[model samples]
Target: MSRGRGWAADDGSAVAEFVMVNGLLVILTLSVIQLGLVLFIRNTVVDAAAEGARFGALADNSATDGIARSVDLITTALGPGYATNVTASTGSYLGHPALTITVQTPLPLIGLIGLDNGLEVSGHAAIESLN
Candidate 1:
């Protein structure tokens, strides 16, 4: 009768196993969510900057317009804090007069401070004329 080391002495391995597995799952889920947030923020900022540059490139617009538009877009989508470092300037794109809009914002990681310099993104559009 007998057959091996008897089906007994089942230590607390199941509990430890569950803990390890669940920990990994939780970490993985959080990482995925964080990545998604980063991507969404990047897209939103880039599009906002581009839209601002386009607006400023209109026949009757100035670099200030681009700055304002960018700030407004970012503030509306994320928060006013994210729009604090917006800037606009005149430039040339492909030999054509252009307006450039730059945006720098915090990339929230653990809390909301993120890196010391955060992330910076810019957009440019050729100036339009009504001649």
Candidate 2:
């Protein structure tokens, strides 16, 4: 009789443990995926900024051109939302004239939605002079 009672008490414990473990595994998997997405977004934005700076540093290009390039690249790669805060200016890098492109974007916390202007990156390229 006592053995029968013990067996009954243990009957549903396996299902409960399974549910808890499965929940933990699912959360872990999602966390990893979200981290990967954040990294990918950061790298893409950085590359776009650098490319825009290089483009604007060309002898024939202007700072506004660099801003436009960055906006276009970001919009195409991510979305219009991520490209909204791009800016460009003339600056000096390593004691030489340069074009700088700055990009501010959201740091995604949950599925591409996150804090506004939480992530920022800049790119610089030496200005080309036709001397």
Candidate 3:
């Protein structure tokens, strides 16, 4: 007697493979997107910090000016929440005066949630003929 074609041992099937592969693909896609966002945020914040430092270092400006500029840039580029932690300071580098800007923004983990003070970046500029 020949076994019927429609009946076979019920075992692992196509559905299971599809589910596994699809889930992996979704995870990979999200991971790539998240990485891209983090990179963008980092670049924006760093650039803002540099700009702030330069502004503060100028003859007509103060550290507060740098801080404000940095905060504004960050707020415009990212959001208000990212702008709250910017600060600027003055010091000496290479035996000459300098300005520094420090920024702390949220580190992105699973969508806008990360450790407190998760990302910290700073920038410096030489004092420009402080008068």
Candidate 4:
């Protein structure tokens, strides 16, 4: 009678294999979650910037109003943790008064495997100044 080379009728150690496989799966899952979170934050900031830019382009737009609108839009669009970093007058990009909205958010992870911080995104729109 003869058993397998690696299994001599007493080899049932799958713990190592299972651990490796499951560890890989866990890492993959974490990566996906992290990516999703980043994408979500990016989209939210984009939306906020768009909204703020839209408001800023209005005829009666003011510097205070621009900042307030940017903050409000960012807060409303992203719930919390989303901050309006800078809102500036872009002047005219294409023969029209332009306003810029910048948004930022902190990442959950750093060098581990995710974004660090100070991730800023901006949006610009033309002003329809009635004056």
Q: Compare the candidates by lDDT and give the number of the best one.
A: 2
Model 1 segments beyond 4 Å from truth? 1-10
* Clash pairs (backbone) in predicted model 3: none
Q: For candidate 2, write residues 44-106 as lDDT tens digits.
A: 999999999999999998988899999999999999999999988887789998899999999
Q: List TM-score per model, in order.
A: 0.87, 0.91, 0.86, 0.77
lDDT per residue for candidate 3 within 1-131, as digits (tens), equals 76655659445668888899999999999999989888998999999999999988888998999999999899999989888788777888778789989999898887777765689999999998835
What clash pairs does model 1 have?
none
Report lDDT (CA) for all predictions.
0.86, 0.93, 0.88, 0.70
How would the candidate models be sorted by lDDT, starting from the highest? Answer: 2, 3, 1, 4
Instruction: Find the 10 residues in a row with the least total lDDT in model 4.
Output: 108-117
Winning model by TM-score: 2
Candidate 2 positional error at 49, Å: 0.3
Better model by lDDT, 1 or 2? 2
Tens-digit lDDT string for candidate 4 (90-119):
676677668877666665563224444457
Model 2 is weakest, by summed lDDT over 10 consecutive residues, at 1-10
Question: What TM-score would candidate 4 get against the native?
Answer: 0.77
Report the Cα lDDT for candidate 2.
Answer: 0.93
> What is the clash tally of candidate 2?
0
